[model samples]
Target: MRIGLLTDGGYPYATGESRLWCDRLVRGLPQHEFDLFALSRSADQEQRGWVRLPDRIGRVRTAPLWAPHEEDTRHPGRTRRPQGRIATGLGRAYGRRDRRRFTAHVTALVESVCAGPEAGPGPGEPDRAADLFTAGLYGLAELAQERGGLHTALRSEATVRIVESACRAPGTGRTVHSATVPDYLAFAAGLERALRPLSLDWYDDDALGAVDLCHAASGGAAALPGLLAKRFFGVPLLVTEHGVPLRAHYLAVPETPLSAPVRALLANFHGLLASEVYRQAALVTPGNTHVRRWQERFGADRDKLRTVYPGMEAERFAAVGEGEDGGGPGTLVWIGRIEPAKDLIALLHAFAEVRRDEPGARLRIFGAPVQGGEGETYLARCRALVAQLFPEEGTDAQAAGDHPVTFEEIGGAEVPDLAQAYAAGGVVVLSSVVEGFPISLVEAMFCGRATVSTDVGAVVEVVGGTGLVVPPRNPRALADACLALLRDPERRARLGAAARARALELFTVEQNLAAFRGIYLDLVGQAPARWTAPPDARHPAGRPRPFATPPEAHVLGDLIREPAVPGAARVPSWAVGAEGVCAGARGAGDGDA
Candidate 1:
C-alpha cells in the first residue's frame, strides 16, 4: 500500500522528536511505499538536512512553517510566487465574494474560540462551538483552494477587526475580552501559519489524492494536510500521537511571552483543532495509555483509540542484557537529555543520601543538555550542585576519582556508546517529574538492568512490575528504592531478568512494524475503495485496489471449475457456490493482496 506520512518539524530531518521512530517505521516496512509531507519548523533545521532516507521513500515534499520569505515556498517543479504577490489561475487574488466568505468563516472561528465553557454544549449533545469551529475551518480551507491562498487575507486589517469583534462578543471568556490590537495581530498571524496547509498544492491528484492512506505522524498542524486529503478525495486518515499536541500546547504556552488573551485564544484554537482531528480520523494511535487518556479527554472516540508503544532497537543492547557480568554493583546510572523537567536536582539529592549510607556507591550521569541555552544553564546548575554536595571529595565533577557524581556524555572513551553506558552501571535511574514516555527506562530494561524510576507519565505502565517506582520529587523515596536494589544483588538480578523479558516481549522494532502493517490493512479494508476519474472521461481510470477482496477469493476463482479427471474428487458445494462471486470480484481490480 502507498502511505502518505505527514509530519511537522520532523521526519527525514536529521533532528526531530519523531525522526528516529519515523525512520524506523519507514525502513522496517519496506514493502509499502511512503511519500513524506514535512513542514519544516525553521531554516536552521532545513539547513541541518535530512537523515539518510531509505529506498522505499517515493517522494519528499517539504514546506516551511517559519515567517514568510522569498525562498520559503519554493518547491521543485512548482512555480515560485513572490512572498506577497497573489498568482493567477487557481491561485488568483480573492474577489469580493471570496472576501465576504473569508470574513464570515474567520468570524465564526474566532467567536467559537472566544466562547466560554458555560456557552458550550453539554453531555451527549452536539457541541455548537465545536461545530462552528469545524465549519469555519473547512470553509476557509475551501476558500483558500478556490481563491489562491489565505496569506494576505489572514493578516489583513479586516481579519484583525473580525478577531476584535469576536473577543467582545457576548458570552465570551474574560481572558479573550481583554484582547488588544497587538494580541489580535499575534493571534491572526499564528492562525494563518497553522492554516497554511490549506493553500498547499499537495492536495491534488498527483500528490495526496493518489495515496491509499494518509498517516499523520502527529496531530496539530502536522495532521492538517491529512485532514484536507480525507476531505477532498475521500482518503482515509490514520493519526498517531506520541505526544498529544494539545497537552504540549498547554505546557508550552505559559513559557511564551505572549499576552494572556493571545495565550487563551491560541489554546482554544489548538483544543478545537485536536478535537476535530480526532473526530474525523478513521483511527487514532497514541504511543501509550498516558497519551490515550489525553486524546479521550479531548473528544476522541473510545472505540477509535489504539495504544501503540514506540519501538526501539533491542539488538544494540542484546549483549549487555545477555552477558554474565552486570557492571559495577555499587554504580547507579542516569541516562537521557538533561533538562529541568528530568528533575536532576532530585536525583542528585537522592544520590547524596545514598552516599551517606553507602560510601563507595557512585553515580554516572550519561547525557548532555538539550539544544538550547536553558539546557546549558540547567547543566551548569547541576554541576554546581554536585560540587557543593561533594565539596570534600573533589572540585571537578567530571572526574570519577573521589567525587561520587560524574556527568558524562555517551561518546566518551569509557562509555563509547549508549549500550556501554547502560552496561557500566548496575542500576538505571529515571527522575523526571514530567514525562510522556520513559524512553530511558525502557532502554535500561532492554539492557536487563534493574531500574528505580520516579512515577510519572508511562513509567509504571512501561516498567510493569519489574522495576521499583517512587513518587516524583521525593528524595527519600528515590534513595530508598535505589538502596533496596543496590543492597540486594539477587533481587536486582531477578528484576533485571524480568524487565528484559518484558522489553523483548513488547518493545521491539519488529513488533511495531507488524502492528502498523496490520493496522494499515485493517483501515483500508474497512474503508470504501476510492476511484478517481477525469471530469470529461466516460470511464474511470484503472488503479490498484487495496484490500478489495478476501484472500480466498483469488484461489477460489481457479477452483470453481469441474474436476478434469473422472476419478478426481469434486470441489465442495460451498466452493462451487463461491465461484461466481470470486470471479466477479476478480474482474473488479487487482488489490495489494
Candidate 2:
C-alpha cells in the first residue's frame, strides 16, 4: 500500500518535532510505500536539511511556510469586466452578504474549484468578482493540484479580498470579526498558505489518490493535506493528533505581536479547520484522552475517535533497568525540554519543601532549552532557581557547579545516553505545568523507575496506576508525593516494576504496528472499494501483498458516486499515479530523489 504521510515543520527534517517517530514508523512498516509531504517552518530548518530516508519511502515534496513566493500572474486593478448577471450580482454584494448568502457563495466557490476549470464558473461572467474569487481559489487549488504546494502566490491580494468579504458577510459566526484592511490582507495571505492544500497537486493520478490510505502524523496544518486528499479523491483518511495543534497554537501565539482581532480571526480559522478535519476523517486517533476531549469539544464524532499512544523504543533502557539503581534513595529527577511551560519555578519551590522534610533529598534536572529566544531566559531562570533551592550549587552569577540539584544535557560524557540519565536517579519526576504525551515519564517507566509528576496533559493517563501524580502548581502536594516515594523503597520498586511492564506492553513499536495494521483492515473492510487491481498482476513473484486492504473491507460498504460534499472535499481523482501507486512514495522508496 502506498501511504501519503503529511507533516508540517517535522519529519525528514533532522531538527524538528515528529522526525523521530515518523522515521521509526517508516522504518517499521517496510512493506508499505511512503511519500513525504512536508512544510518547513524556517529557513534554518531547511538549511538543516532532512534525515536520511529508508528504501520504502518513495518521494518527498516540501514547501516553506516561513517564506513567500511571488506569483507570476497579477491583476492590474481591482475591477474586471463581468459577462453575466451572476458575476455582476456577486460583485455588487461581494463586499457583504447575509449568512445564508455567504454559505451559498462559499459553497459555490468551493464547488467551482472542485470541478476542473473547463467546467468551472466561466471567465468574465457577471459574478466576475465572484468568478475571480472562484478562479483564484481554483487557480491556487489547481496550482497545488498540478504542482505540489503553493508558497509565493497564496499571499496575493485576490485571496485576501475573498476572505475579507466572507468574514464581513452576514452569516459568519460572531467569533469571526470584520478584519481591518491590513489584518484582512495579512490573514488572507496566511489563510492562503494554510489552505494551500486546497490547491496541491497531490490529487493527481500519481499521488495521494493512489494510496490505500492517507495517514496524518499529526493534526493542524499537518492534517490539511489529508483533508484535501479525502475531499478531492475518495481516499480514506486516518488522522492522528498526539498533541492538540489548536491548543499548541493558543499557548504559543499568546505572546506574539498579532492584534487581538487577527488572533481571534486566526483562532476561529484553526477551530473551523479542526472541526472540518474531524468531521471528514474516517478515523480520528488522539494520543490521549486529554486530546480526545479537545476533539470532542470541537465536534469530532465520538464513534470515529480512537486513542493511540505513541510507541517509544524500550530496548535502550533494558540494561539500565537491570543494572544497579543509580538514583540515591531520596533523589528526584526531572527530564524534558527546559521550557518555561514545564514550570521549573514550581518544581524548585517544591524541592525546597521536599528538602525541609528530607534534608538529604536532591533534585537533578536534565535536558536542554528549546531553540527559541524565550528558552534562553527560561533556562537562566531555572538555573537561578536551582541556586536558590540548592545554595551549594553556586550563586546566580556562578557558572554551573556541583550541588544538590544539577542541570545537565544528554550526550555529555557523563550521561552518554538517555537511559543512563534515568538510571542516575532513584525516582523519576515530571514537573511540567504544560505537557503533551509525557515522553520523559514513559522513558522513566521503561527504565523501571517510579515517577512523581504534576497532573498535566497526559501525565496521569500515562502514569496509570503506577506513578504518584500531584496537582500542578501545588508545591505542597508535589513535595508530599516525592517524600512518600522517597521514604518507601519497596513501594518504589513495586511501582517501577508495574510501570516497566506497562511501558513494554502498551507503548512499544510492536503494539503501534499491530494497532495500525488492524485499523487498516477495518477501514478497508467498511468502505466500498475505490479502485483495485489484481495482486498477481502487480508483483513479480505474485507474493500476496500483506498490507493492502481487500476490496471487501471498505467501511462505507461500497463506493457511492455522490456529488461533492462541501468542506469535506478530498484529494483529486487523478492524484493516483499510474500502476495504482502514489508517484512520490513509489519513487522516493527507490532512494531520495
Candidate 3:
C-alpha cells in the first residue's frame, strides 16, 4: 500500500522534531511504498540537507513553510530544489458572485473561531466553518489552477478588508476587537502562507490522491496538507500528534511581538482548524494521555483517539539495564535538552535540599543546550545559578570545589553516548515543570535507574507506578522523592527493575511500529466516501477534481471503499492484502532498504 507520510520540520531533515520516529516507522514497514510530503520551517533546515531515505520511499516532495511562494511549476512527486524567497505575486480574478461566496465562507470561518464551546449560534445548528473553510480554500485553488497561481491576490487589500470585517462582526471576541489594521494585514499575510498547500500541484490523481492513507507526523502545519489531500480525494487521514498543536500555539507565542488580540485571533483560527481536522480524520492518535485529553477537549471523538507511545531503541541501553548495580550510591543524574521548561532552577534548589541531609551527594547534568534553539541563555543562567546556590547556604564555596555539581555534554570521551551517561548515575532526576513524555526518563528506565520526576505532561503515565512522581515546581517534594530513593538502595533497585520491565513492554520501537501497522490496516478496511460538489461552479470547464463525501454523513464505515464496497476492480492491487504482509512478524529474512 502507498502511504503519504506528512511532516513539518522533521524526517529526511538532519535536525527536526519528529525525525527519528518517522524514520523508524518507514524503515520498520519496508513492504509499503512511501511518499514523503514535508514542509520546511527554516532555510537552515533545507540547507542542512536531508537524511538518507530508504528505497521504499518512492517519492519525497517538500516546500518551504517560510517562503513567499514557489515560482517553480514542478509537480510535488519530484523534489523542488531550495531557492530564494520571492515576494507575493498575483491572484485569479473573482466576479461579483465569487466575491459573495468567498465573503460568506471567510466570515463563517472567522466567526466560528471567535465563538464558544457550542461553537455556532444555536445547538446542533452547526458552525459549518469546516465546510466553508474547505470550500473557500479549494475554490481559490481551482481559481489558481485556472488562472495561473494566487500569490498577488492572497496579499491584496481586498483580502485584508474581508478579514477585518469578520473581526468587527457581532459576537466577535474582545481580542478580535482589539486587533489593529496592521495586525489584520499581518495575519492575512500569514494565512496566505498557511494556505499555500491549496495552490500546490499535489492534489492531482497522480500525487496525494493516489496514496491509500495520509499519515501526518505532527498536527497543525504538517497535517494541513493531509487535510487538503482528504478534501480533494477520498483518502483517509491519520493524525498522530505527540504534542497537542493547539497547546503548543498557546505556549510558543508570547504577547510582546504579537498583541494579545492577534495572538487570540490566531489561536482561535488554529483551534477551529484543529477541530475540523479532528472531525474529518478517520483516526487520531495522540502519543500519550496528556495529548489525548487535549484532543478530546478540542472536539476529537474519544473512540477515534489512540494513545501511541513514542518509541525508542531499547537495545542500545540493554547492556547497562541488565547489569546488577547501577552506578554510584550518592549520585543524581539529569539528562536532556537544556531548556527553561526543564526547570533546572527547581532541580538545583531540590539538590541543595538533598545536600542539607546528604552532603556527599553529587549531581551530574549530562546533556547539551539545544543548538540554535531557545536554550543558550537558559543554559548560562543555569550554570550561574548552580554556582550561587551552594554558596548562599553558608556552605564553603571553596570546600564545595567546583560546586558539587557538574554540567557536561554527551559524546565526550568519558561518556561516549547517552547509555554510558545513564550508567554513570544511580538515580535519574526529572525536574521539568513542563514536559512531553520525558524521553530521558524512559532512557533512564531502559538503563535500570530509579527516577524521581515532577508530575507534568505524561510523567506519571510513563512512570506507571514504577517511579516516584512529585508535583511540578515543588522543590521540597522533588527533594524528598530523590531523598527517599537515595536513602534506600534496595527500594531504588526494586523500582529500577520495575521501570525497566515497563519500558521494555511499552516503549520499544518494535511495539510502536506494530501499533501503527495495525491502525493503517484498520483504516484501509472502510468504504470510500461519496462525492460532493459546491453550490456554484460558474465556469465548469476549468474546475478541478470534484470533492467527495458520504451522501448521508461521514461515519467510520466510509474509510475503505475498494473491493469490499462493490467496485472491486477499481481498488488498487496493493491495497488488497496489506494486513497479512505489513502486519506480519518481523524477521532477518529481508535486508535493510
- lDDT scores of the candidates, listed in order: 0.82, 0.69, 0.74
> How many Å off is the CA of 275 in candidate 1?
0.4
TM-score, one value per model: 0.89, 0.77, 0.84
lDDT of 2 by residue, 209-251 (tens): 6566788887878887777677665677888888999899888
Candidate 1 lDDT over 36-90, as tens digits, reads 8888777678778899999889877887777543354446444443222222222
Error of 1 at 218 (Å): 0.5
Tens-place lDDT per residue, model 3, 100-129, is: 655554555555554533345366675565
Best by TM-score: 1
Q: What order do you get sorting by TM-score, best first?
A: 1, 3, 2
Please state the error at residue 452 of candidate 1 in Å: 0.6
Full ranking by lDDT: 1, 3, 2
Residue 88 of model 2, lDDT score: 10
Give the winner by TM-score: 2 or 3: 3
Q: Judge candidate 3 against the unseen true structure and give its global Cα lDDT, from 0 to 1.
A: 0.74
